[model samples]
Target: MCNYGGGLGKSLKPFVEYNEPGKIMIIETPQSKSAQLSACWGPIESARAKVRGAEGVIVSGNVRQVDQFQDAGLPVLSRGIAALGPREYMRLGSVNETLAIGGLKVDPDDILLADDDGVVVVRQQELSQVIESCEYGVKHDEVVLQAIAEGSTMKEAWRKAYDLLGPPVEYARPFRR
Candidate 1:
């Protein structure tokens, strides 16, 4: 789900209406210099999202009520937090549309995996390939770690692991040593 807007007033209804189990919500606010520094979501919205079965939420803008979001057990990733509400500072623009977030293009239904490290977007069409690559990477890492534990130098361990598994696939190269 992708929402292009500045406020949460009119947008929340449609956001709830389109709710689907296990779907991540991606919201984008206007990037103009004059845009208000108000929150796009708060504790109430977080509770509503959890009840509606949303997997998580990613806001390309601010959110408020930090403690309440944690209390509601909702995983919300936002650019920042604001004390002001959205009512006077923003207006709804669009929903379920393409959005440019942090210089990456995000479309509805794209797979978003986020953690303390950061967020990674996997296009729907590349899901299988990405999964396969990830599985292989995990196994490869284990082999390298084992070699290192057995007293092999870091470079030697990496070389031995590479020999055993062959070079990683192109997409998985960046993750490998």
Candidate 2:
């Protein structure tokens, strides 16, 4: 979701194309000075829908409606601020136009991975592998957390996490919307 409701400039943008969650969607409308479009998606609404329940939102583009999500503490990863907003800056440029988001090529159904660290997109074929890896990492972290709670040193906790997850998968894709 790009552009909150501020409405500034940059009119004529992509229209509402897709609404499915847990999938990657790219925007290729050229690189704006700031990929910040604002959240027209309505953060609270998204929460109600429970889109991607446990998954976080990764906006290679922009996100507005900050207050809603900010209050709820929902995870949203985007480029920058969008004072202009959607109504003014956006015009349904193209639905499913294969837009470039933060320099990442987005295709429908691509898996999106957003977390405390940041957001990243994975190919459709590679999506499963990414999810599995994330789960593995999460479980590993849990063990380390418990160890720490049990008075284990930071190094020991990290070691335990490492031992459980084996290794972390580095995201090789570059982010530059």
Candidate 3:
């Protein structure tokens, strides 16, 4: 789930109101390309966010105390890590607004799915379609795996799966090899 917000910089001011359970906090720094900016998040904030029920965090800028973040049980994806905290170097920005992260435009309420692989954003309107496609892909993979387990070669497995499941989804076909 995704509930978009910024204001991750160091500040005495509290942002508790913006916290929403089961939501991922997406933060973007103003001058993200510059090395001067301090880490937007750290261990303490990670713990706090988790207490507030945040599923995870993603920062367009740097972060700190990565190990502590893991200890806090909050999954955080950041550009990099910084020794310095955001105090003095940066301040909280706006919340619940559109953000540009790595050339992708993230809007409020957009669904964010992340794992060791990476994060993928799905527009709110496209959620149902994306879920359907993913379900189809899982079924297709099951068929392929079953075929391969039954002594079929890789190519044969794919062919058998395709014959049983039809062609791969449009978006996934080009990568099917």
Q: Model 2, 175: alpha-carbon shift in Å?
A: 6.0
Superior candidate under lDDT, 2 versus 3: 3
Candidate with the greatest lDDT versus the true structure: 1
lDDT of candidate model 3 versus the reference? 0.72
In candidate 2, what are the lDDT values of residues 75-175, reduced to their tens digit?
Answer: 55565546555444443444444446555666655556666676566777777676777677778778988999999999999898888767776544455
- TM-score, each model? 0.84, 0.54, 0.80
- Compared with the true structure, all predictions reach lDDT values of 0.75, 0.53, 0.72
List residue ranges in candidate 1 displaced over 4 A: 6-14, 33-36, 87-89, 172-177
Candidate 3 total steric clashes: 0
Model 2 scores a TM of: 0.54
Residues 1-177 of candidate 3 have per-residue lDDT tens digits of: 121223455352355347789889887665534543568678887878889898898877788878777766789988778888775535665677777776777787788898767778888777787787887799988988998899999999999878988876654321111
Off by over 4 Å in 3: 1-13, 31-33, 87-89, 171-177
Model 1, residue 65: displacement in angstroms?
A: 1.2
| Worst 10 contiguous positions by lDDT, candidate 2 | 1-10
lDDT of 1 by residue, 1-177 (tens): 545454454655567557687888877776654444778788887888888899888887888889877766678988888887775435566677777787887777678898656778888888898898887788789989999999999999889889998888556422211
Report the error of model 1 at residue 73, Å.
2.4
